[model samples]
Target: MNATTVSRLTSFAPAAISVLAIEGPRTLEFISKCWQPNQGSSVLPTNRIRFGFTKATDNQPRFGCNESIVVCRTNHERVELHCHGGKQASEKILETLSSLGAMVIPWNQEPCLLARDPIEQEAMEDLVHANSIRSTAILLDQMRGALSRELKRIEQLNANGKLQEAVDCILQLRQRFAIGKHLIHPWSVVLAGPPNVGKSSLLNRMLGYDRAIVHEQAGTTRDSLMERTSFDGWPIDLTDGAGVRLASEASDPIEIAGIDLTLQKAREADCVLLMVDPFSGWTNSHDRIYQETQGKRILVRSKADLQKATSVPPSLLFDAQVETSVMTGEGILELQSAIVAALVPEAPDSGIAIPFRTRHIELLNRLIGL
Candidate 1:
């Protein structure tokens, strides 16, 4: 008989639990050879779970966990093995099973057995690897045919020759694609400014902990520090770049490398938090740094607690700017809201149809043409 193919169906990172699926014509045979039931005979019911230990090729306990795992033969061709969710633990279990002749692959490399339709399939596929809860919810919404229902109505409108209404609907839906695409990937938000301007302070305040170092010294940070955190339930990668300094002000070679990374992060960032020490107000240096961010920037005035109105220039203005005082914890919430607004200002109404994958977007674009 052919070997059963095994694939991990859960995240590889350490978690509370991990699941692996084995499917093939010989899945039952493979399980019969390796699975040792705790209290009953080796015969497994089609739909019931049997608490057991998997044996190595030499017939020794493979998992040998403090608590044994439960195995289920879901059907004639499929079996599922669930175990503790550590990288090494799960990998060891998989390795043990593989030694007895099971082909191993990632979850996406294997087709989902229970997906009911195309929408469900896509949602299931995306949901499995989704890095954030928001992405999971969005995928679940799509699985309920959220996008399908909207497309159906659009198709009907096209059939009725109501071209104007259809065009308007398509335009509205098209606007949501960018937001949807970022649901899984996360938008990169870079904190950039001159040294001691409180870029790191803002980052720390927003994250509710001191992830970045805050000091009075210039060029204190010479490396980019990044963290992935959720804002208003949406995922975002917060990048704290090294402070931007004038060519003569660059402290050393390390600072130069850090400055290079700062510029690179600002250029690549989906949203740039361009900070200025309001105590000193807006200056020519701030303006020069602002120019480097181009269109993808949000101006922020830091140290509002030590505000000096005269230090601020009258002509200082930005399309997106907020006053923040990390010491007093003011405007931090507003800053978060502004970041979300800058990244994905408009989320679809709850339960509304929205494309969750590139394939769905492509099809919607085709319909827009029609």
Candidate 2:
């Protein structure tokens, strides 16, 4: 008898539902041992989802329990169990399956056993971690053979002695990698500026809810607060760093540490919003912070409602600048647009082949010599 294998297919975090996959020559027999269909025989037909309750075998009466579940038979050898999300219901089902001679394996391993190619395997693995609707669609396309088809076309081009065409195709695909890489791992944008510059307010405003503490005090935020947010379906991490103050001005050790961390994160961030309250105007400390995030920084004029209209400082507006007022709800949309433009100037059109994994990039690099 072939060994039956079972694995949980979704994240363990509590949700409305969870899925488990069972596959092997004896999968149906093993499932029938524990599954008690609500309205029909325990024997499940192929390709039909049946409602049921799972229970431990009579021999193992000590662990007896019933969990409401729905099972889908993909084939004679494969079935899926959908149950309430969390550890309890799924754990009971797994325990019952294990008792019935099914081998439990890691969820990641299931893809390797079923996928036709490495690309499909990677796509299947990453699709589970996609955070946004757009990301899910892109990964679904890849899993459905978008990248595989493109690679086959490239191979055909190279074999036909069209070397230049193949090279150009690879170059074009590489360009999309910038966006592809961020599909699973979001781009990081840091909010860095001097104390009392409205960094916290801007963070709360952009997130559409209050995440960081907003106070009038200079050092209200002494630590970093990171939140995941999306703009136009692009995933991004916005980190609100502590209010950077001059070392001499900051007397407390904890405040000094926070300032140091802000500068460090600013240096490492993909983009930094260096803010300046127009009421206080730009100072020497602002210039120093700007130097830390020189290339990947945007100049933001905050508290715009409190100040009279004035031209943006030409020297400070290196990347781009937006005037914002949290109280009046002004310039927030424009700021989001600026950020999207800075990070992703152009999103990939639908159905485009995007190299998303390290292995895909390495293979493309090797093909350049061909």
Q: Pick the candidate with the highest lDDT.
A: 2
> TM-scores of all models?
0.83, 0.92
For each candidate, what is the lDDT? 0.78, 0.84
Q: How far is candidate 2 from the true structure (C-alpha RMSD, Å)?
A: 2.2
Tens-place lDDT digits, model 1, residues 26-123: 78777776667888798878989889875555643544453356788888788888877877767876776787778998776564544466766677
**lDDT of the structure predicted as candidate 1:** 0.78
In candidate 2, clashing pairs total 0
lDDT of 2 by residue, 265-290 (tens): 88888889988886557776787788
Worst lDDT run of 10 residues, candidate 1, spans: 59-68
The per-prediction CA RMSD against the true structure, in angstroms, equals: 3.5, 2.2
Model 2 scores a C-alpha lDDT of 0.84
